[model samples]
Target: MAKDYMPPSDFLRALIDEDVEIEADDTATIKRLLSFFKDPDAANRDWAVFLLGQSEVDTKAVRDALIGALNDEDDSVRAEALVALAQRDGDLARPHVLEALSAEGVYPTVFEAAALCAHPDLIKPLRGWLKATGDKEVDQMVAEAVAACEASAK
Candidate 1:
């Protein structure tokens, strides 16, 4: 989604307005965004989760919603949740980052989260992944994540 573009749905648009109004910390907006998690369209759910991730609210409701979103069917949504959670708290993001690293596929957002958290536990898996991926870009992402983890380890 474009930075300035809002979702075409009226409800989503209103939610965006409310997010802007309260700087994304309002209870009602958060509740509606949480409800949107159940939307049939993955895009809507993804967008809703993305908005929730951007929220400054640190309530248990928001954190639980982000953690729940890690199980979303869409990879991007899960990635966003991981990144958001990592940005907020390294301890909270560590296990999930390890799990994502152990997963079969290469997810760039997972690397992003790994880099953001820079926990020592991630270094081993990141080194194992180095140059193993056929995709150079992904390998580079792993390298950077490894570097971040190593720096933090030191």
Candidate 2:
């Protein structure tokens, strides 16, 4: 006899609840969560995509999906993707984050990306941005990233 499948909302929560127990076998669950990234409901898609990243399952598919989402039209989706990419590979995401920062009207996305970076080298570019644009928030965030990078280096 087969077990009954719960509805998606409940299922997702259940998956999260089971995260600790099944931590070692997240590959399959991550794939299943990735499928929801295309859901019509932006909230569902965003949450699913975010959860997939949190799984931290190292695989080509996960990396591709996160990279693709970094360009998502939705700002939150893009932010989540940037954060995931930062966790996966900070060096790889640096260029894209820097490009976004230089683009006008892209500060929010750029800021989110920079927050994820936590790399000291990002301080140079971020400092340049601060000097050029005089955006205090970005400057503060970059300062925090710099601190984090410095602490990690020690």
Best by TM-score: 1
lDDT of each: 0.80, 0.64
TM-score between candidate 1 and the true structure: 0.82
Clashes of each: 0, 0
lDDT per residue (tens digit) for residues 13-126 in model 1 = 666677344345467756877887777777787778777776676777777878988898888788888988888887899999999888888578788889999989999988
- In Å, residue 136's CA in model 2 sits off its true spot by 8.7
Per-candidate TM vs. native?
0.82, 0.67
lDDT of candidate model 2 versus the reference? 0.64
List residue ranges in candidate 1 displaced over 4 A: 1-8, 13-25, 134-136
RMSD, each candidate, Å? 3.0, 7.3
